[model samples]
Target: MKFAALLRSAALVTAVALIPATTATMAQVDGRAGPEFAKLFAVFQRVKASYVEPVEDDVLIRGAIDGMLAALDPHSAYLDGGDLQRLETMIDGNYSGLGLSVVMEDGAVKVVSPFKGSPADKAGIKAGDFITHLDGTLIYGGSLDDAVAQMRGPSGTSIKLTIFRPGRDEPVEVDVTRGVIELEPVTHELGAGNIGVITVNEFSADVGADVFSAWQDIKKEAAGRVAGLVLDLRNNPGGSLDESVALADLFLTDGRIVSQRGRARGETMLYDAETVYRGDMAEGVPLVVLINAGSASASEIVAGALQDHRRALIMGERSFGKGSVQSLLPLGPDAALKLTTARYFTPSGKSVQEGGIKPDIAVPQISDPDFALRQKYQTRESDLRGHLINELGIKDEEMESDSIADPRFQLTSAQLEEQGVKDFQLHYAMETLRRTTKSTVALRPAKR
Candidate 1:
């Protein structure tokens, strides 16, 4: 996901090849840290002079930059050349690739989530699966960028991925054909009883407007007033923050949508309702938002807002807990810094960092036969290395809600499939709406 806006900030660039700093500039270093700064330059000089194999200055400098950023957080990184291009392609929502969002987890490439309907998703790649090899080439300790590059090719081309899913004893191999990923950020369907179902794949540009249009189409399809609405954000890895607030605003008349708190002045900002849209578009309609372990960043923003305002019944598992925001700060023509600049909060001042947005009603996807086993390895922000901890400490019990069995979710995957329920979470939501809508002319809006 394209996380945030391109911001400009003052940077400290050190010339690795040549120490070109003037005497005046060199003197600006704080006296307390002068020894540490000297040690860095000394190591650079020693590496260049005595390393057994000659290393390019660019390579050393890039490695240094990467190492520096790597020490910060997983989301922070130095983007340039192919990395920059990939970021742009993601924002444009068109690319010829495996359509997967991956992160380096202790040197292994881990799938964050595959884009909905993409080749990876279609090929049965699940979140938390480790990609050990690409086309038989071992990539366990390889650069994530290189592994990602290997996964992308012209449409119709194919690649083999050796995956290591956590709960499995043996590694699995899958051959997947590449395709152009034209992401449809928002898609809708009119179900039985005029219940509108809108699935937000990601919070890309104009997502809020696209969702609004989808609702209009759903209303048209219904040929009358729509019943309850389901905003499906399951497995959505999140995108543009502006679009997230805009989406929340679509269903809110007034009140704060989200607030971002950062160490910088510009990073601290508040987004409120009525800023993007004037009023609630689906006023008085019952709403249920579906989120799972893959729902993160902007997805959490929307879910948290609607939940805090009592505008929607949040169902499904807890979110990915990515409350931190990353700003794409341009460093040069070909490079930018994807730095974690702020931690965002829900309308009620709750941060979804280590502990994600807890669902109002926890519902498991029992339709997937592997759901029970896969739950053991589902990767959330808390599982990430160097992830930010929530200021308000989360209790272990809060995160264990999913483990507690419920009588309502006893149906097995085979049983659900035989009953024509392809998606248990979605079916459950629609059923909830259907049962609730029977007694009211229109579902009353919750008290704000």
Candidate 2:
């Protein structure tokens, strides 16, 4: 079955609960009525009473809820009771079932990507795989929300997935047993010349404390005076917004970390820097932040704030565009709605909406031969030309000269190849820090 049909099925199921015959009187008496509500009720009632076959009220209500939320945006979604439980497990850094991020695309549920170290990842579930069935049931006619509800369960639970892979004539079936998934917040190591390399996976509730703990550990290992710091934020789909603000304040003594503006809000609320630097580190240290397409929301906030404040040099591909802020609204009876409440801005007042923050230097990843071949065929020089123009906001005349180049910006494909850093974004950051720190030491005054 087609993906669109599945989504329609899910939406239809949720809409049953909101059938006008069952809900209009209560909704109106509850004082939530306006012209929109009145029209919605009329249509819902007409559909429920006019349908030839008897339809369950529960199914209609659920479908309405799903349709309502899905209309808002891709990220804002209505999670059923079971799906909500799974989200709670993810936030707590533990969950069961196939660890894959799936979304309704082109009406069929498609795998966004499998989480690293997940059963789905290990089982070779690739991005863009269309889930045709779950267990013995035909999932092609259901909503993505309902599909997720069917997929999640307790640890050690086994689920079978039938996927339609690209370039394959026949579908593939994979049976995977769920396991407890634990997220690693901070991972640090001492690189060449005693440089501190720290990778922050996500900005969860405990991320602030975890970063501090990692910094202390790295400081001890470095014996003070670490040459430089390479903070890796690649593939980090952001979590807590509050945590991102707090994390940015750790390295900044004074400045507006971030700001938020809503539809009605004329004034922009600013989050200022902490009074003191919590970490025992001085300002003007050589810092390089690594970012890529996966760095989003809170991660983009940190990268943008730091780059705007001149605290760190951002090096990598453009980040994921997710500037909108979401607030969790409790819908009585143990249900909640995660709604997009506001749009965030960098300290410099740039709105990173569809347009993401541009890196100080653009280093295209060409480490893999297969990736290079794909790029050659799919993306020509003209493709990158528009990206440079749009991201830099430069006119065609400005590119006539070579003034756009910066001396500090260096590409590290060769060095990365030598170090076997297929994930070359992080290697580029480390090398940038090493070069910047050497320059800083040379420019420093001699000891008295």
Best model number under TM-score: 1
| TM-score, one value per model | 0.90, 0.73
Instruction: Please state the error at residue 61 of candidate 2 in Å.
Output: 2.9
Backbone clash total for model 2 is 23
Candidate 2, residues 231-341, lDDT tens digits: the string is: 788667676666777777777767777887755333235777783245325355677778766667788888887888777778777766666665444454455555555
Could you tell me how far off, in angstroms, the CA of residue 326 lies in candidate 2 after the best superposition?
Answer: 1.6
Clashing pairs in 1: none
Please write out the lDDT profile of model 1 over residues 1-448, one tens digit for every residue: 2323322111110000011223121235468998987888898889999999998888888988888898897788887777766655545548888889887889999898888889999999988899999999999998878998899889999999999988889999999999998877889999998899999987766888999999989988996788799999988877777788889999999999988887754667798999989989998788999999988888899999898888888999988888888766555455666677778899889998878888888899999888888887777888778878888888757766645669999999999999999899999999988877533422344454
Pairing residues by index, what is the TM-score of model 1?
0.90
CA lDDT of 258 in candidate 2?
Answer: 81
Per-residue error at 103 for model 2, in Å? 3.0
